[model samples]
Target chain A: MVSVQELLKEYIDEGRIKLDPSVNHHTITVHDPCNYVRKSQMAFGDHMGDLNRWITMQCVDPSLYREMCDDPMNNFCCGAGGGAWAMPYDEERLAYGKIKADQIKATGAEIVMAPCHNCRDQIMKGLPKVHDMGNYKETLYLWELVANTLVIEPWSEEEIEKAHAARDAQFERDGIEMEEEEE
Target chain B: MAEEAKPMEIHIDRKNRKIGGIAPELADRCFTCGTCSGGCPATGLVPMEGAEGVTWDARKAIRAIVFGMEQEVVDSKWPWVCTLCGRCEYACPMGIKLMRSFRAARTLRERDKVPGPIHKGTMMNLERGNNLGIPKEDFLYLLADLGKELEEECCPGFYVPVDKEGANLIVTINSKEPFGEPDDMKFWWKIFYAAKEDWTVSSVNWEGVNWGLFSGDDPAWKEQVRRIIENARRLKVKTILYPE
Candidate 1:
């Protein structure tokens, strides 16, 4: 399987993508897929170092990033894998995912990037219903976050004004006072 | 209270009982080779304390069966915990189908006696045609609602067709996508749009999450498969795509 984190780093390195200013200001956490981080052994071997370097180069803080499980190579199955999702073990499956959900919540990051489909589904379902971790922080695919950050095209002044107006409108609707930030 | 209790007698059903097989013979043939256990994931799960344990290690469970100790295997928790990932079979020198045997033992148990919530989900799927039990009409409504929202907000001219006839492909989605995480449906929709594939999602039996297969309910499994196949035929779709 293609390593999504590596792909994102390569895009950033090539100047083909840039992080959204809003995202850079907010805390972001990534949930390492067991298959990618452990089974593939790429997370520790090389990808981890590369990803850390890239994040620093981008001026994004890494404190929000959480440590993965100990002995991740032999990590407990996420209960979604090996057909557990289809099996008659909802409570057990939910119980298995509790630690992962707690780990994400402890980071206090505004978003959790889940790469694998099974992990994503389990986290999305188990986190909210079982763990009662509400939808305050978004759960996104790694690619989606990278896509958001890439500076594909510079917005025209008019487009920028329109975007600001939308943001203001959202703030007004949420009853929050807005303070302009220095560029 | 002072009366002596009669001795309890155990009765064995011979006709329904399974006899021991070559597994024990093969165990006897082993020349103290550690090759099999070294590669087996379940090796540590089983108890191995002494000489008898080692001699019967390979066929210990098999010997239990041959000796009519069926409860030893049937009541064990090992079967449910095994993921059946096939790692053991691949590494075993004896090429033993330990996982297959475990699965067979699980299958022999009565439905109610089978441990796990998967069995209940399987029964639900059989009775309601989907494990999540969203009524057929409700499922259609949700699809329609999502299709409208997508077309209005994100993708113009995008439609999630339901039971459309003669479509090139029929796609089945997990019910959880519609019931719990509706936004996740957008990812697959985005992919389909990029590919520009002709496809239709069925109003009936559209869920691809087959709990029957996981719960070892063959009749329910067949019913679920039949429902999907029948729907595909009705829609005249040539191919069925099951998204992960």
Candidate 2:
């Protein structure tokens, strides 16, 4: 039930870790499973997109993010949560997920970010079969996104030099003067 | 004149205090707002033949239950088709528990009459410690194989240990990992590897999913949980991370 991203944020605030937000390059939209969030009544309220947005933005460019309609607790169940995927009623299950599939389709984002396993399974399986998100990538867990993007150790010498160069170039482009070095 | 609602034959089992999984006390709570039905993805989502006049949506189902039409609720395919995602229950201002009622209603049906995989999964869970009904030997083999491959790829010499005594954590795994989606398990293993987590998968009661919970079998659910706890104790692990 914990938002590990928020935990990572806490660690960052405490100066325990550094995160590189540019780790992800995919255009992403998020799916909030109903179990963890119950439409504004539970788990940080209906717009988990707020949290998801911040978290995803932390891993990738904010411009690459997309929001699905009826997000957070308002998000439709991808028809796979609640043990429905294991059930035998495939046709009905697919039908029940039409709204969810439609929502995913509407987003048109390359990757549908689903933080829960069941939701990811449902969306991954059903989106291609039931909806038309065939070429879209499989869903990704938020934790995986965070994990993949983490700056576990200090930057390499080459990385630091490149970063400084990029920073000075950006600042120069913005007509800002560099601070003098200590004597 | 407004059309009078026709009452049909049915009555509550007062001794049971509810039909299926419903609380008879909440039976009278619905205000017939159609809120549940409006939010539901399955209300009229299915075009079943006999659902013509039957009540299946949250509000209408509550109305029927309050009127003691418990049998009708039990009989509808709505219980199976509903997916039980539990949106209506949370959205209900009255705090109606629709999904559990549907699940309870599902359980009320003859065990043989329940939906296919759910019934099978529950039976398999009770009999084989997992819904996949994979024999212990085969399960172990897959774990060993995958662990060896992963160990070679990342951790070099260390394997994905199973039933390691006194490990810091005894972790359960979803059967789906070993059955349909083995690669997904790699994701978690990498994390554990990175963190140097002292965790071991159990050789028995390793299934994380409680199909018993899904199929409304209380005893089976309790038994499954108890088995995992037992495994943790036997291994003397400090923590038990239940599989999600």
Candidate 3:
């Protein structure tokens, strides 16, 4: 029942994934997904709002990270939560998103890390067009941000062979054909 | 033909009123201090019908529900606009669970009246295993292609394992990724390859999102949950990572 954010943080802490913050230069801010953070807090008595912050902060330069005026649990929705993004209430959704657009503008960050898909779409595609954003550049998934900054060390030939063998064995066990590669 | 409209009457004696299992009488705990409304971005945005320069807010919705105005509240666009973000509950001095009440309001709407694409998407997700109704062969083909591309990019031996029994993790995906943003799928696979974790993606009923929560269809959402659990059991996976 753990989120991928938890798993990513665990892997990083365990040294399975190494992050290089120097690879990224743009100022970034993390948008707290309401369902992922606030609602979960109300229901489960615990949330990963802080963990998401910790993960995002690890992926960028210390100076490049920015915080919105509102803290994680108290942050504004991207206006797309509760299926508004998929719904036809474009007027209301965009009107609600004006607050988020302002928050991003105030941060002056080039990138807004939206961990949830709905937040990402609204922040990236829906907000800036109407809000007249100046500093806003792009939106990225929390994991995508980490993946881009990953410092991948090349594996040895033996390690490569072992991984190949393991993958092949997995496919075989699942009764899947390795030869069915799509063109 | 010009009969005057009657003013909406409030039922003062209707005590112990509940909406979607959440008691609307809890509105009595509210101070009407406007903290919830002020903190909510949805406030003042729901334009008041037949009136100028006025709108509804969370506190207003609570009051409406208390007055046994469930049908009016259900028909209004107020609940859908709220987004159920929990900011009001988070900041309420009265410690009111505003989002829960709002979610309750959402459930009051008729299925046909549930706002755009959500009801249809829920039905599609139930019938075809995804919101977009992408067929199994197409989904599998797209995954295989993406897997090969990711393998060629950085992870040489990388492959998206489907329905691998006894894996430690079973992952669900948002239909949007495979439908439009297929490249985004690689971010997690890259992580999986790096960690060398034992995880498998289910070939069928792999959608991660349950829009029933949005449309207020509790039964539909529950059925969606059941499908995921059934998939996990079929694969014998101990963990379900629904990263929506």
Candidate 4:
């Protein structure tokens, strides 16, 4: 029942997680997953659902965030929902995703932040490469961006040594050897 | 302006009135509102072959299902075109499950005619304990190997804990990661590292996608669920992160 987006919201709200949007530095649009946003429990009695109010916005700079024309509950599907992503219909799913592709293109965003596995795959497969705009956008998981921009305590040599020791123990414990470092 | 309009025939096959005879609540609910069509992303995209150029519409498809035109529904390519996103179902004032109905309609087709990749993935899930059919040894190797690579790259202490008993989190991964882009696995590892969460991925039945559900293959879907459940039980993890 606990979604990562809601968790991210909680972390940011409590001031435990600080995000620097400039680290990502892209005009980004959120691709709400059907399962998490639309199929999940609804907002305070609003039947149509409020997807545009995605709490994930808390992790990004609102000014840089772009909204898809038909967003949230009313948003067009990426054509990968309902297990269709695994369904064997390639041309059909690709055709079905055209609507989503159009929406992404209209936003002019360089990145599409899709948290769901199916959504990420569908958009990646559906983004047409023939267009000048196609193949330029990067599909990223919500957490990837968060991790990419996370302000971490710089790795001191002491920490690095400890990490290397742990890695060595793991390699030894798991019966794995490090790949040889090439010259 | 009206020269006695001919009365339209209202046909309903009582014997075949229900959908798969499992539940028929929405069988007679569609009043041909066309709202579901408006919300569908695939509505006007793909058309059935040899038909007058018209887009796929859920209301019309549902009407066909309700009236016992099962063969026509199955024959149409529009069934395949449906993303099953449930947008139509969500938009339906009648609250009909449009996607389930489409899946039921899809089942009416011959097993051989079902979409190929999903059909294969479904078979693979039953045979190999996951959709991608990743071998157990290789899966374990990749987990250890990738953990080393990830740690060297960005995550300093990163190690993909495999089959670690009594871990707090039992996270299942998308098969796409191990079978294709291995680098993506590091994203979750980084998050886990930042949070300092104790997690492990099972060496057995590690794939998170159940394509059997996509093809309406019960035994295959059940098999997938059983393996994940057994792995988690065997590992004695506190919680599972199977997103699907």
Each prediction's DockQ?
0.08, 0.15, 0.63, 0.41
Candidate 3 lDDT, tens digit per residue, B115-207?
888999999998998889999878876776788788888987677888788999999999999999999999888888777788999999999
Worst 10 residues of 4 chain A by lDDT: A43-52
Interface RMSD of each: 10.2, 12.3, 2.0, 3.1
Model 4: colliding residue pairs: none
Docking class of 2: incorrect
Question: In terms of lDDT, which candidate is strongest?
Answer: 3
For model 1, the stretches where C-alpha displacement exceeds 4 angstroms are: A1-183, B1-70
Q: Which ranges of candidate 2 are over 4 A from the true structure?
A: A1-23, A39-58, A69-71, A133-135, A143-183, B1-17, B20-22, B47-55
Query: What tens-digit string does per-residue lDDT give for candidate 1 at B10-126?
Result: 554434453223243332233334554443333434343332444223245444454466566666544454444333333346655544455555666678876656777677777
Per-residue error (Å), model 1, residue B27: 9.0
Of candidates 4 and 1, the better by lDDT: 4
Q: Model 2 over residues A1-183: C-alpha lDDT tens digits?
A: 224444445544665544577767778887776754563355354434556667677778888877886546656778766577877777877877888777777777888877677787778776577666633676787666765766554335575455346434533543444346342
- How much lDDT does candidate 1 score? 0.55
Best by DockQ: 3
Which prediction has more favorable DockQ, 2 or 4?
Answer: 4
> lDDT, candidate 3, residue B133?
95
Query: Against the true structure, candidate 4 has what lDDT?
Result: 0.70
The docking quality of candidate 4, as DockQ, is 0.41
